[model samples]
Target: MNDTYSNGKDVIRITDVKLTTVQTRRRTGAISSHIVLQLSTDAGITGVGEISDLDCYRMYMPDPAAVKMGIEKVALGQNAFEIAALHERLLAYMPSYFRYANTYPPFTPASQIAAGVEMAFYDIVGKAFGTPVYNLLGGRQRDRFEITYPVFQAKKESDTERYLGYMDALVAEGVTRFRYYVGVNFEQDENFLIAFRDRFGDKVQLKALDFQGHHHWKDVLRIYDRFRQYGFELLESPSWREDYEGMAELRKRVDVDISEHISSLAQAMRMIRAGAVDVFNITIQSGGIYQAKKLFDLAEAAGLKSLISTTQEMSIGTAANAHLGAVVPQLHYAGDPVGPLLYVDDVVTEKLRYDGTQLIVPQGPGLGFEIDEDKLAALQAGLVEWDRPAHGANYVSD
Candidate 1:
């Protein structure tokens, strides 16, 4: 798209690029790191983006140290408003890393890189036009959205008590929905669910988000039967993430909602055809913001519910998700962009605001957060000491 604003002289050209790598700690003491992208324009406008470290998909994560030169090659000296063409160039120029995972859609780390770049470009465009990124995508659909608090697997009584404490605090602040990890120790999980319902009562909602879905459909049915009385509205990935047939079989056997991560548009379609899931959990990691919109659009067209999933991103990445959450019509349920609330510290000058369970969509000109350059520099300096893989924690449970 060409730059055509009310003022003929509003065009901005990207001049320089900077990539800052930063790491933050999750509430559970897990390390969460991101590569923050900054683009400087000739018109004195700067845009920011973030590339998050996805836990299970770490093998597919591109080295941030190596991504800068590639970004410079594709993004430098371009008209800042030609984001579509810029995105095309980015996709063609960056490495896709398709062989890292043997999954259905294949893990493409390049998409994450593209997403970071696209996020920066969208920030620049929104700033230039003096509007929020959601307005640029479409008009705002909702000012605020619901969010589900993530609670890990409770292995013992103390674990359950600790989680209950967290939930009580959140509930006092207006949070009512929670998601727990299952498929681990069934007896402990059952006990935790029982305690959870007893503590919060039926006014609160619970859902299961499992990372290990290696069980057979019959086994999954048994697990579901055990937890059915607790009133779980949804169960995500009861079978393997890509096991559409198995998921379809399970869906037929139970009335509880099922959800799967949409890695690609083709995967969503396949799942839809198989009647596998009642919901599709999408994240910016699936591609960039635009690609996520496409997947959500597809899910809505098929009459399936969708929610914005998280990769445990910090403020900037969460800001981008906030904009998506604002415009996406199918995002009817609670999203998981709990980074601003969960991260110990963030690179943004002011983290996104969280009110109870809802994350208020940023209303500023760009992705709505400013970079903390000093913090970014500090994080980069300490990168050599960290083995990211060794410090990584599970997204659902650890």
Candidate 2:
């Protein structure tokens, strides 16, 4: 509707834009790389944006290179306020090589470009309104969010002691809720849950487990039976994606509530229509703010809870998630907005902070945070060469 930032002009020229990668180390032994976008106008006002790469399925997709070339090719001399137009143009012009193995798959490399452009557009809108994205979404519902700590693969039984020690320190630091992985290592899962129960003894009210689609339906049911004794709040991805029939059946079997990792709003609607999940894990990078709001509205109508989860994304997506989680009407569960806390360092001007169990939405203009231009330039200068990988680590192709 109102393009106030455009000064009543039909078009705002996109003067310059750049993309850089920031690598953050995670305790899970995986390094996360964020592709940051900087968009500037002729009037000197600028916006920041980011997108998450599809690591599990489409890890070979070189999203940063596509994002860089896509912005350079389509964003120049265009109106930043014309978000829809820019998004569509980028979608049309994006190289077909970036698409996944199957053309019909919902998640693809093009989706990343579309998400990045949408976020950049949101940044433009936020800067124009002089309000944070959260305020624009629907005002703040909660000042903070409960953090969900991720526990990946554990080596030995003794490793559970180290993990408990780590959680103990975090609990002292004001984190009350925690989520542990329940895949591949059932012993670790049992040990961690037992340790949590023994040490905390129900002091931690919120405890959950995530299977990440690494277990069978029967195994999930068995795990749920065991987890019920410990009073788990929820279980995420207990079954595989596209197993709605199986999920609905498990919903009947499991004593604990189930959450789905339906990344896009389309899948969310499908899950709701199928009555498969009790909680919806809304990821902003997978679906833009508009679509995310639509998904939240649908979830509300379907009487399902909402939890803002992370995709190991950067500050741009994290800021957007915080705003969405703060403003949404049906955010019943605490969000997994712990990317900043999990990372060793971030490449943003203002870092997202945890207040007790919650993360406050930034009150600054635009996405409520600013970009570090110096750090961005330095990161761009550090890029030696970029190429798209194929298949596995051994396969290399442009």
| Per-candidate count of clashing residue pairs (backbone under 3 Å) | 0, 4
TM-score of 1: 0.88
By lDDT, the best candidate is 1
Model 2 agreement with the true structure over 1-398: per-residue lDDT tens digits: 44554656545577888777765555443455557787887756677877653443343646566567767787888877676576567647753312221111233555555666677777777777677777666788776666676655444687678777777877787777777766656776677677778988877764578776656677788877776777778888777647767888898887777887655655666677777899877666544666567667778888888778766555667787777777887677777777776665667776777776777777777787787777555544221124433211122322
Determine which window of 10 residues in candidate 1 has minimal summed lDDT: 97-106
- lDDT value, candidate 1, whole model: 0.75
Q: 325-358, model 1: which lDDT tens digit per residue?
A: 9998867568888888777788878889888878
Error of 2 at 306 (Å): 1.7
Local error of candidate 1 at residue 101 (angstroms): 9.6
Model 1, runs deviating above 4 Å: 1-10, 55-61, 94-108, 155-158, 211-213, 378-398
